[model samples]
Every structure is written in structure tokens, then in C-alpha cells.
Target: MAKTTLSLLPLILCLLYISGTAASANFIKASCSATAYPAVCVQSLSVFATTIQKSPRQLAQTALSVSLARAQSTKSFVTKLTKFKGLKAREYEAIKDCLEEMGDTVDRLSKSVLELKRVGKARGPDFLWHLSNVDTWVSAAITDGNTCMDGFAGRAMDGRIKTSIRARVTNVAQVTSNALALINQFAAKY
Candidate 1:
């Protein structure tokens, strides 16, 4: 009986470790689930869980960086879309409008990244100010992405173009919204 109990101890410890790991992974998914697009949030952020740990500020900064990169890439994609040949006048107009809004989104995301960086280095009362800036910029980025999609609403554009643009813009918006939620969470800790 004593031998059996000792043998089971190792198994119990291993089970405990496994459970703890699963809980940690669930923590990341739970945080992501708080966003508008839980799947996107989890996919984009889960990779950074080890580095992010439980730091709200780190999570916010990482989210901002992801959003910035996506916005920049989408901006480039939309720019090329504008130059696509054989577009009708209205289609061209819609794409052009989308391009402009995407540009704004990119710019706002860039600003958020910068502000988040500042927030990371800040250690005084000014931290709140920098954090607030990050929140505002991320919100603006989300709005910019939405505005881009709004341009396509009711427009008689090619179905392919419309779908492609909507997917890209929605991806950016989801990421930005995730960043904003993280920023707010961090701010509340202050």
C-alpha cells in the first residue's frame, strides 16, 4: 500500500502540471474572447502568451504592434487594389475611398504603437496620459477600419473586390479592438 501511494504521487504531480498549463492557455483564450473577434484574437495573441505573461501593459503593447503591422500591410494591399485596371468609375471610387480610410487606420495604429512604447517606458503620473493616448489612437484605428468598410456599403462594386476589402478591413478592426480592450484593462490597473 505504501509503495502504491508513493507511485501515485508522481502521477498526481504530473497531472497538476498539466492542469496548470491548460489553465494558462485558457487564460490567453479568455482574454482574447473578450474581443469582438474571439478567433482572430486568440490566433493572433496566443503565440505571444509566453512573452506576455500576465502583464496588461505588455499585452496592450503587443496587440498594438500586431494591429500596426496588419494595418500597414492592408494599406499596401488596398493601394495596389486602387491601381487594379478595368475598374468601373463607381468601383474605382469605392476602392479609392477605402484606400483613404485605410491610410487613416494605418496612421492611427502607428500612433498607438508609439504611444504604447511611451507608456512602457513611463513610470510617473505621466503614465496615465500616455496610456490614454494609446487608448484614443487604438479607438481611432478601429473607427478608421470601420469607415473603410462603410464606403462599400450599398455600392455596386464587384463581389470579389467587396469581399476581399471587407475581410481585410474587418481583420484590422478586430485586432485594433483587441488592442483597445487591453489598453483599457491596463489603464484600470493604474
Candidate 2:
């Protein structure tokens, strides 16, 4: 019995030590998880910034496509303005002026994007702000796009045109929302 108890004592102590170690490890893991948001945000932003950096040519190509589309739409609008038979001349002029203002605003935004791209190239992965509020980041993106659309809407001379612009703006807003959600999911996981 004495020999059996001596052997059992070491086994018991070993088991107790293992359990203590495991419990401490688990506690650390839980604590890390609880405080992981900022780190996750930083990591995800880094990945996103890197992705953006990796495809500068592609981004520029996409921007070109956007510019082309906007130009085509503006041409169509100008053609329509020239042929509008029912509207008074002054009304048509007002619409044309509004469209011109909106075009200038879009041009400014495109220029800003170009500038941002240049800054991003020079700064590497430091272009994106280290933001903790995922929602706010998303909201800002949407607001920026919407502000452009709003400039168009404010200049819009007719309900039909306003509605069309609003639909397009909503689509852009949805895309921005999706991007934010994706970023947030990545932040949560890593």
C-alpha cells in the first residue's frame, strides 16, 4: 500500500500541473479574443491596403472605364438636351447647366482618386486610415459617392432624371456597404 501511494502521488501532481497549465492557456486565449478588435482591424486594413497596392494598373484601368462611362452618359444627356421639344428653352438650359455642374463635380472626384492613387503609391501601405469604426468607414465611402450624386440631383431639372440618378447612386451605396461588411467580417475573424 505504501509503494502504491508513493507512485500515485506523482501521477496526481502531474495531472494537477497539466490542468493548471491548460486553464491558464485557456484564460489567455479568452482574454485575447476579447481585446482583439483593434489588432484585427489593423491586420485587415493591412491586407486590404496591400491588395490595393498590388493592382495599381488594374485600378487605373477601372478608373478609366468609369470615366468613359460617365463621358458617354454625359454625351447622351447633351444630345437629349439638344432635341427636347416639349420643355421650354430656359428649362432645358437649366438642366444643361445642372448637368455641367455635376460633370465638374465628378471630374473633381476622379482627380481626387488619381491623387489618392499617387499618394498610395508613394506611401505604400499607409494610405488607408487605421480605423476602428468599421461602420463609419463604410458610411464615409457611401457619403462621398452620394455627395456626388446629390450634386447631380440638386442640378437635375426633372423628376425622371432625378429618379434615374438616385437609382444609380443607390447601387453605388450598396456596393460601398458590401465592401464595409467584408472588411468588418475580416476584422472579426483575423
Tens-digit lDDT track for model 2 on 1-190?
9999998999999998667655544432332243224333222233233223324333222322343344345535544654667865555665565455445434543444454335335432443332233245345545655554544434434566556655554544443343344434433432
**TM-score to native of every candidate shown:** 0.82, 0.36
For model 2, the stretches where C-alpha displacement exceeds 4 angstroms are: 1-75, 124-190
Model 1: pairs clashing at backbone N, Cα or C within 3 Å: none
Give the clash count for each candidate: 0, 0
For candidate 1, the per-residue lDDT at 189 reads 81
Give the range of the ten consecutive residues with the poorest summed lDDT in model 1.
Answer: 17-26
The prediction achieving the highest lDDT against the true structure is 1
Model 1, 1-190: lDDT tens per residue? Answer: 9999999999999998667656656776777777777788778987777667666777778888898899889889999988888987888888898888888888888887887888767877889888777778778778888878776777465489899988888888888888788778777787
TM-score of 2: 0.36
